[model samples]
Target: MLKYYNELLYFAQKLVGDKEKAKDIIQETYSKVLETQNKREIKNQRAYLYKVAKNVAVDEAIQNQKLQTAVYEESEHLTQKHEQPEEIAIKQNQEELFMQIVNKLPKRAREAFILYTIDEYSRKEIGKIMDITSNAVEKLIKRATLKIEEELAKKGF
Candidate 1:
């Protein structure tokens, strides 16, 4: 267990992108693995540790997203107002155009961009989910952003 601490910490940091949060995740992973071990016989401790760390990181991300959404909803509610008909129409058209532009992106780039921006996933997480390297994920996202910007510019947006 002590021998795997540094490796697990590095893995967790890559997943969560924060040293302190990664440490917390490692602590949770160790706790869960220990609790589970006591309840039953264990096999493949290394894989189990990684699986637990990934689960903890994902759980933390979901909890954080929920908290952020709650705060955003509250603030939006406070600032809510009825939009004029023209304003509503303009917003709808802009959204439609944005979707069209996004759809024009190459498949991998589009997927990476949506995962990073719309789904709020970190590059490392996206890479894991997409079965790509983090550098590849970064490149795909940048490519998508540049294409979207060029399209918008052409459209006079």
Candidate 2:
């Protein structure tokens, strides 16, 4: 429990790209995991923790987007307190650029990259999550990396 704190925090931070948000995510993940009797029922405890963390982080991201848009509709710039205008602008710019790169990837390849690279999911677990072979996951990751590299090189990265 205490041992995996840093790992879980790191995973959530990668998923959301925010430290405070990541802390919330980790706390929620712990709460959810404790709610299920399966906590003591699973042999693969670390994998279970990671899976729950991924699900919670992803859900929070999606929910946050909707909430932000609603704030915009109200003619309010700040979705959450402490998010300054310049910071928001920079974040939006980065997100747009990142999505542009991601758009170049095939659907499955992008998903594989998100799971493996961003969420740090194991190859075997990602295969199980995506319902594909681990070999296929490897191939998809390779292709996705190449495509991203090519795109970045075009921009002189």
Candidate 3:
């Protein structure tokens, strides 16, 4: 098992994009293999491990999509319905300020940051959605954060 660790990690990361999630999938794959209790009966342990890792990654991704959908639905019902005019004006001003900051980001970084902060997506999920690697997603987010902070400072916020 240890011999195949590096390959398994590479394969899982290719499929899932997130290093942490890939590691979790690898761990779960091992747990599933252990659960069988008939290791001697298997002929191709390497192939079996890969198969388990694929299935686990797919299952986790589907579960994550469902959870994101549920959270989005719940948030829809939680928005404040009644606001004083003064409060509404203030909120609008804040939104405008935020948008100004966000607009200053590079296109990729803007999308990543919005998906991560406003849409509540994981870095891995954001990578999948953006068709980029998780490491790329992380970089975009970091860049976006720095840009936003700089903009806020310039605006005396």
lDDT (10s digit) by residue, model 3, range 1-157: 5676787888788767789999999999988977764645543456667778878987897788855654566476554643422235445656788898898788999999999999999999999999999999999999999988888787667
Model 3, position 144, has a per-residue lDDT of 95
Local distance difference test scores for all models: 0.82, 0.75, 0.79
Q: Give the C-alpha lDDT of model 2.
A: 0.75
Which ranges in model 2 have alpha carbons more than 4 Å from their true place? 1-95
Per-residue lDDT tens digits for candidate 2, residues 70-116, read: 43553643346326332454455556666799877889999999999
What TM-score do all the candidates reach, one by one? 0.48, 0.41, 0.43
The root-mean-square deviation over C-alpha atoms between each candidate and the true structure, in angstroms, is: 20.0, 17.5, 21.8
Superior candidate under lDDT, 1 versus 3: 1
Which candidate, 1 or 3, has the higher TM-score? Answer: 1
Candidate 3, superposed: residue stretches over 4 Å from native = 1-87
True lDDT of residue 39, candidate 1? 98
Off by over 4 Å in 1: 1-82
Best candidate according to lDDT: 1
